[model samples]
Target: MNGHALVVGEALVDIVRRAGSEPVEHVGGSPLNVALGLGRLGRAVQFVTRVGADERGTRIVEHLTAAGVALTPGSTSADRTATAQAELDEKGSARYEFDITWDPVEPPMTADVVLVHTGSIATVLEPGCDVVAELVALQSRTSTVSFDPNIRPALIADPARGRARIERLVTLADVVKASDEDLEWFAPGRDPLDTAREWLSRGPAVVAVTRGGAGAVAVCAAGTVEVPAVQVEVVDTVGAGDAFTAGLLDGLWSFGFVGIERQERLRDIGTAELRAALETAAWTSALTVARAGADLPTLAERVAARKVTR
Candidate 1:
C-alpha cells in the first residue's frame, strides 16, 4: 500500500508454563503478533496499542523495532504490562489465562495510515475499545479498516457482552477475520457460514473464518476462496491465526484493495503474485510453531525458503 497500516490492540506478555511448573515470559499479544508478522513480511506497519511502561513494554518496543515496525507513541502506560499464561497441550494447542491492563493512555494521530487493524482486547477491554473506535473514526477519513475478533472465551467475563462488542466492531471494519471458536462462542446453535455471511452483510467487504489445521476461507461479494492449510509438525500454536490474518492483509495490501492503491491498478496482477505472499505468511507461521511462543521468522527468511522450495 502507498500509506502505512496502523495495528491497534493490546501488547501483552505471553507466559508459557515451562518444564518445572514455572512460566517463562515471552513478548507476545495478538495485535503485536499481527504487527510483527506484517512487519516481517515486508509490510510497512505501525503499532497503535498501549503497553505498560515496564520491562515487558520495553521488550515489546525492542521487538517491534527489530522487526522494523513503527510506533505511534503515547500508548504505553505507567501500569504493568498485560500478561497471558498459555498452557500447552501435548498437541501444541494452548489454553490461555490473561491479566491485561484496562487503562489506556493517550491516543495518537493516524492521518497517514492506509488501513487500521483492530480487535481482541481493543474491542472488549475498556479504554482500548474507545481508542479503537477513535481510530476507526480516523480510518473513515484516512484509510480502510480491518479487524479480527480473535476471541478467547476465557478473556470475556460475559459471552453476551463480548459478542455485542464484536457486533459493534463489525459495523466499522471493512474486513474481519474470526475463528470457528469465535463463531461458536457468539452463536452456539447457528451455522458458522451463515453467521459469517451475516457479518459480511453488516458491511465488512469480506469475512474470513479460520479453521485450525484445516485451513481458512474468505467470503466476499466478488467471490469466495478457501485456502488449504499446510501440514506441519505440532508445536504450540500461540500466534498462528494472527499470522494467517497478517498473510491475508499482506495479500490485500499488495493487491491494492485499500484506497491508497486503486484496485483497477492491480487488475493485471495474477494469482501467482498473491499466492506467493500468502504462502510466505503460512510458511513463516509454520516455522514459528516449530518453536515455542512467538518466535516469528523474518521476511528474508521466508523469501529465501520460498526460493529453495521452488
Candidate 2:
C-alpha cells in the first residue's frame, strides 16, 4: 500500500455487440482496466496512455478519474482515440477486433514508483512496444515490474516475433500473468503450468496462468499453488484477466512484496501465501465477470463478498 503503481499501455473504448442486444460502448483497454482496478482498491495509481482529445477520450479520462487514477501528462495527445469491437457469444465470451494505435505517452522516470505494469498491445505493437520494453528494463532497476501478454492473436502479425518480444519481457518482469488460451497459442499442445514454470525459470518470481472457470495456478520459488475459481453469474468476460492482474498485484502489495526492497521476499514467497493471493485474484475476476463491461469491484465490495461467503 505504501508503494505507488505506474501503468503504461493503451486505453480505448470497447464497442461491444451481443446478439439480441444493442451495441454498447465501454471505456476499456487491458492496462487501463488494471489501473482503474488498482485505483478502486485505494492504491496510488498513475496511468500513461495515448487517447485523442475527443468524446471517447473524455469518457476514458472521466472513468479513470472517478476511480481515483491520475493521468500522466501528455497521455491525451493522440490524433484519434482507438476503438475495439467486441462481439459477444451466447456464453458471454467475447471476440475482439481492434482499431488501436500502440503509441503511449512517456512517463517520467521517478524513484518513488515501486511498481511498473505494462502489457498487451503496448508490448508487441511497433514503435511504442520498443519504448515500453526499454522503460520496463529501466524500471526494473528500481521498481518491481509486472507483465501480462493478454495476447490478441489478431493483433499479432507474426507469432514468432510476438513470442520473442513476450519472452524478452518475461525475462525483465518480476511478475507475469497469462491466460490458458494465451499459453495454448504461445506453445501449442503444451500444459499452461509447464509454461508458467519455464517463465519462472527465466526471471519472473511469480508466473500465473488463469484458466477460465477451472481456476488459476501459479509458480514461485517455493513451488506451484492452485486456487479454485469463484462462481458468479455470467455477464461478459471483458477485463476479467486485467482484474485478476490488479488483484494479484494488490495482494502482493498487501503482503509487502511489491517494491524493489521486497523483491527478494517476493522471490522467496511460499506456496500458502501465493494461494491466498490467487484466491483474492480469483474473487476479483469473478466480480468483474458478474458485472457488465469492465466494471471492477472496490476493496470494500471484495471484502464484503468474502465476509458474506464466510
Candidate 3:
C-alpha cells in the first residue's frame, strides 16, 4: 500500500544450512525478496502475501514493515510459519525442502505501476494459486504484470500440467522471467528462447531468460537483446533474479517508460526499454550475488558503484 508496484507471493523464513549442518534462518521468498529489492531501490512497494499467524509470521511482518514496504492482511493461517530447509552444494547452490502452511492473500485493487509474482512453488502450492491467479487477472487490465516462474522440478511432477499452468500465467503477465532451468522443467524438448517466444506471443510484452554466468536475454515485440552478466565473484545465486526484477522496474522508471494505458506507449516500453532495463537489472544483481545475503543495493548505491572508475 502506498502508491504502486505490488509484489505478491509467499514470505517464508529460509533456514540455510551454512556448512551443511548449522542452519541460518533468513526472511526470504522470491516474491518477498523482490519486494525487499524494490524497497531498497526506493520504489513505493506493497507486499501482498500470506503467512501463518504465528511468531515467524509476526517477525516477517515486522521485518517488511521496518523495510518500509506495507503489508495487507495475508489471506491464510497455519499452526506454524512457513520455512524452507536448504541442502547446500559445495559451490553454495541449494536444493530446498519447504514446510508449513502455504496461503496467498490478494489485497483489494490499488493503483500501481506493476504487480509482480514469482516463486512458482508458492504460487502453485495450493489454495494460494487460485487466489493469486485472480489477483493477477484483476491487475492485468490496468497495470503491468510480471511473472518469474522460479520452477522447482521436484514439486511440479506433472510436466503437462506444469506447462499448461505456465501458459495460463503467460497470458496474464506483461513480463516474464525464467532461467533456462525453469524452461526445461516446463517443456523439455524446446529451446528456452523458443519457449520464451511462445510466452511473448501468449501475452507478455517481454520475456527474460537469465543465464547464470552467461548473462540474460530480453525478447519482446520491440526486438530482442542480450545483456551480458556483470562478472563478479559469486557467493551464491540466492535472490539474484529477484534483484534483477527490481532493476527492471527501476530501469523502466529511469528510462521514462511511462503508462501502459496507451497501445503505442506500451509497445515502446516493451521494445525500446527492455534491453536497458535488463542491463540495469544485471548490474544490480551483480551487486547482490557479490554480497553475502539477499539484500540488494539501493539505487543510489548502484549509481555510486557505476561511477567509480577502476
Using lDDT, give the best candidate's number. Answer: 2
Provide the lDDT at 83 for model 1: 87
Question: Which tens-of-lDDT digit does each residue in 179-244 have in candidate 3?
Answer: 888887677888989988888888777789998889998788877889899888888777788888
Model 1 clashing residue pairs (backbone): none
Clashes of 1: 0
lDDT of each: 0.75, 0.93, 0.75
- Where model 1 places Cα greater than 4 Å from the true spot, the runs are 18-22, 260-281
Top candidate, metric TM-score: 2
Count of steric clashes across candidates, in order: 0, 0, 0
Clash tally for model 3: 0
TM-score of each: 0.89, 0.99, 0.91
Off-target runs (Cα >4 Å) in candidate 2 are none
Off by over 4 Å in 3: 75-77, 112-119, 270-272
Q: Taking the tens digit of each residue's C-alpha lDDT, what string does model 1 give over 39-93?
A: 9877788887777778898898898998889877577754678889888776778
Q: CA RMSD for every model?
A: 2.8, 0.8, 2.4
CA displacement after TM-score superposition, residue 163 of candidate 3 (Å): 2.2
